[model samples]
Target: MSQEEKKSRNGGRREAEPERREKKPSRRRRRAGISGVLLYVLFIIGVSAFLAGVGWVAANDVLALNKPEHTAIITIADGEKFGNVIDDLKENGIIEHKSFFWIFSVMTKSKDKIAAGTYELNTDMDYRAIITNLGSHSASRQEVTVTITEGMTVAQIFQLLEKSGVSTVEKLNDTAANHDYKFSFLENIPLGKATRLEGYLFPDTYKFYMGQDPLYVINKMLVTFDAKLTEEMRQQILDSDRTIAEIVTVASLIEKETDGTDQGKIASVIYNRLDHPNAETAGFLNIDATIYYVTGKTVTQADYQGVESPYNTYLYKGLPPGPIANPGMVAIRAAMNPDSTGYYYYAMNSKTGLHEYSKTYAEHQQKLASFGD
Candidate 1:
């Protein structure tokens, strides 16, 4: 009875072992399926994270958000390439991720829309704002206020314009020398010299765009001059023996000779010498400032004798070829109406800061000697 029971138990144990082995493989398969599903989910998560990072970077540059604050004058030269502009933006810290910006520009068709100019750009400006600012409109251009003083020469004015970022000196000089302005005053002034329009550019405060065209700049001054010389003054000039050029030349002399106090008195001396050629003066105006204009130096009497030029009034009989400096309205007015006097000679008294006039050469010499001349 015991042997039969042991054999039945052994047979049952063998069958149970096969079932346990089958169950072990099922559990292993379930664990393997679960691990495969977990790995697939992790891969999807990683891909999503990478795409999110890329999107964030693109959005940052496109929106110009979270960028460092910066302001720069972006000068886009004529026919400048878009790639070079992108490089400038990157260099100026106005933009990051230039490739992304370039792609954005291409998509928006902003590359060809940008015009040549100087624009004030800042990091606060979005990509679209930056592109909009680079257009040809006046609103897009940066402005500068320049004051051309009364006594500034054409060369000095051009240099100041260059330093003020209004325009380059080369451009100003080219326009001044070549452009033929249609004006009565400029009609006699020939081309090929920048100083031809020197006496006519009305000195005043002007507002100009950075990188402005030189033609427009010169035209503005010419127009101002045309407006400044009134109809009354023009008619008076026509009625008088002197032409506008001569009056302006005389005014330029008066401007250099005297301060604001005695322009009319100085004009009287000039007219006395020009209208009435005396034996002592020998028809030579003998003004010292004209020599300085030729040599561009502080001329003494010794320096004057050495200088030989049409502009040297000591050597020349009459007025210089053109106005030595652009005269202000006061000097111009003084030239229009001279003081009634017989004075043919004048000398500036350094201590008194005024001119003492004399009728004769001997009296002029005495007055000059009194001033320690």
Candidate 2:
């Protein structure tokens, strides 16, 4: 090539190379801009997805999920594990998801605080509210209060139990007859009677949960009786030279014999008659209450002679075989500590519901004539 032609071509090539470099940079910039736009779009999508996930978790963990309308009872038994409780709650439709509850409990540090009891829960409760309810003591238990009055017979007490829906009469009677109570007072209770533990069921108001076992109710009553019969009372019975059975039997008679005001004097009259050498008429006790106990009705003159049971104190000389009815603390205390009186016979004033005492049959007759029964 000629020198002039080479120089012109080289100059033209250099100018074109500068223009090519500029074009290359512009192409690179266009590609970089497109990549930047794509990266920004991806970042926005990731952020939206993260926000959606957070919203889902909050709805499930904190919000009130699907639940039923009415309240349902859930029994969390003793020593139940948290996993088992969650399973129970889920199975009972109290919660839609166990995982959400588990996560929420973990976050709130309430997994170990769940108490064991019978909880009445409603679907309107949120997860937090339900957790709070289960954790508290008073919110978890359902109780029924039963008031047993003084002098209630075993049959009457069982009837009250059946009426209160605490237990059936058959179940309560069976439990009272067969269940082996651990109380010291129950050690001497004989077996095979119609109502073996008849008078030992302490008369008082009691609070029991619905659907509790019949044995549990019986045990509670017996335990209450044990608690009420303090150590001093037991020692008093021992010092009186009488068995506990004798004292309770006498107390039951005293409870039926008169109004509660003069139990100590009535107890004294009973002791005087029992110790009198020629007191056969009064020593027989001829108690109308025993006849009522046997016949399940008021004692008539014929029933005094015709009744055949050993519980008929009218014919028997000593205390009855067992207590005829449950006596209150007053009668029990009166029996244990009788007043030292000389009276051996007594009659109740029909209008006054009070007793008139006498040392002889003629005096008793004069009192009855005065009272006009």
Candidate 3:
């Protein structure tokens, strides 16, 4: 009876052990499958991150690479936004990828640091280099010195500006006629006229940058004029029963009439003719320079009497529509404070480079004969 019971128990235990071992293998298989799946997911994640890193590095290299050979000029106007500047870079071929440049700029917090100015850039400059350059003002400036002489016409002034490489004649003229300047003297200038600023460009030595905006160059000249025409002088001009325009016109006439040595005397002659006792009969200025100004030629008898432009002082009595040329501080002073000379006529003395004055027509003729005019 003991042997039969022991054999049955052993048989049951063996069967139970086999079932438990089978259960263990199934659990291990399940665990191994889960682990393999987890490892595969981690490997995929690592590969994706590596690809992103490689793309980022490539983008960074492209942004920092320069490919152009020659230099280019980029102008960022005042109040221009960073987005607009990025567009300009794209349009100018300075950057190939505007979206990337914008993104990098934003990430680096450099969008707000850009400055407004004329930049000397090149295709050889990378996006980062261009950004850094635009942030600095003096980095791209090319300064130039220009000396504008007194009694220069608007055309002449522009010619000088063009010659100095400070601006183009077309640009200067356009700016002079259209741009709104910040000055008291410009208040009376007719903005629509082509030659509105003809007489107001003060003749002086000026230092400017090459490739500068034409409006900025014009403003610099106007500021010089404002600075040169002192407060006291302006007050004097106001005290005189003449407008600033009228004074400038008269000064321009005096500047063109004779050399600076006899400016006061010539100014007196102009005033005498304008305010003569018999103004209706003898008020004509009859300035040959005015005729030349109208005809754009040296004064000839045909040109003098043929032209009917308002600038012809021989035809009209008062000052022209505006100044015919730019006048210096000296000429302006002479026009404002003329000598109390009774003479009403003047002619150049070719022998001495001085002028001969006369109170009568006969005396003027005699002096002209003596000067061999």
Candidate 4:
């Protein structure tokens, strides 16, 4: 009886142990599934929050919202890279995020359209408006209008242009000396010094952007010179056995020497001396203005022979290498058409406030000596 009871009890205990192990595993599986579902929900919520935060920051920067009032002058220099411009905007507090703005610029194609110049920008400007404000014709860009008068020297004109903030003197000189301007008048003119385009930069009023390109500034003046010299004027200059350069050089001398009324007579006197090279003047124009052009000061008695520049008419027989100053159309016309006269010498009469012409050096000296009385 004891052996039968022990075997039944052991078999029932083993079956019960298997059922308990299966039930325990089911309960543990339910609990683990619930924990995994909860973690998945939490991860989704965290990701959504992070994306929303990033979107909010990007929107604020694009729309320029919640930014302090800040005004700054952003200068995009000539040949300045767009990356450097973005860095400047970031440094000036005009933009908060450089990478976002750069991406936005690429998307909108604003990087290629933005012009190089000084522009007034503020923090209130959105990314789009900032890009627009820095454009070529934007009103935010500063401009200055300058009027160059007649007879102004190249150096003086460059200085005036620099003072007006149109461009720096160094940039102007470099461009004038090196930039190959496309114009018929500037064709034979070599590129080495700023004075190469001296007489061709016609004087006129011009409106230029602050920090504008030096080539553009110089081209504007050359275009004016081309337009001012009509076809008729050019043909007349070419008809004579002289280059346009020589005519301009003679015109410059006439502009500086004449008292505004005697340009034709002065022109005649100049041609008479040049035509008779072996006369008493001995092929020397002996003009005092040319000496002044060399010395940049009033010519004294010693300067007539002291100065050795090619521009010195006392030293050089023919025309100077180039123009001494920019001449007006009136003086240019006078150079083209000289009055018929045999006068070989002329002197400015201090008493009459006009030039007194003489056919001989003796008469010229007599008139000069009488001016002192």
Judging by lDDT, tell me the better candidate of 3 and 4. Answer: 4
Q: At residue 143, what lDDT does model 1 achieve? A: 80
Instruction: Compose the digit string of candidate 4's lDDT tens values, residues 90-173.
Output: 987899999999999999988888887766677789998999888855435588899988788889899999999989889999
In candidate 1, what are the lDDT values of residues 1-373, reduced to their tens digit?
5767877978845334434433456788899999999999999999999999989988887798888655555668889999999998888777888998899899998889888765657678888888888775664568899998775678878999999998898999998999767677877778999989877877899878888878777777776788799999999999996899998889889888887789999999888888877556777889887887888878778768778789999878988998888788888899999999988888889988878999999998898888885
Per-residue alpha-carbon lDDT of candidate 3 for residues 90-197, written as tens digits (9 for 90 to 100): 775667677778888888888887887766565666667877888987535777889899999989988888998988998888877887664677776668654888
- Residue 62 of model 4: what lDDT? 90
- lDDT of residue 262 for candidate 2: 93
User: Which portions of model 4 miss their true places by more than 4 Å?
Assistant: 1-135
Off by over 4 Å in 3: 1-135, 277-281
TM-score of each: 0.63, 0.63, 0.63, 0.63
Model 1 lDDT at residue 212: 81
TM-score of 4: 0.63
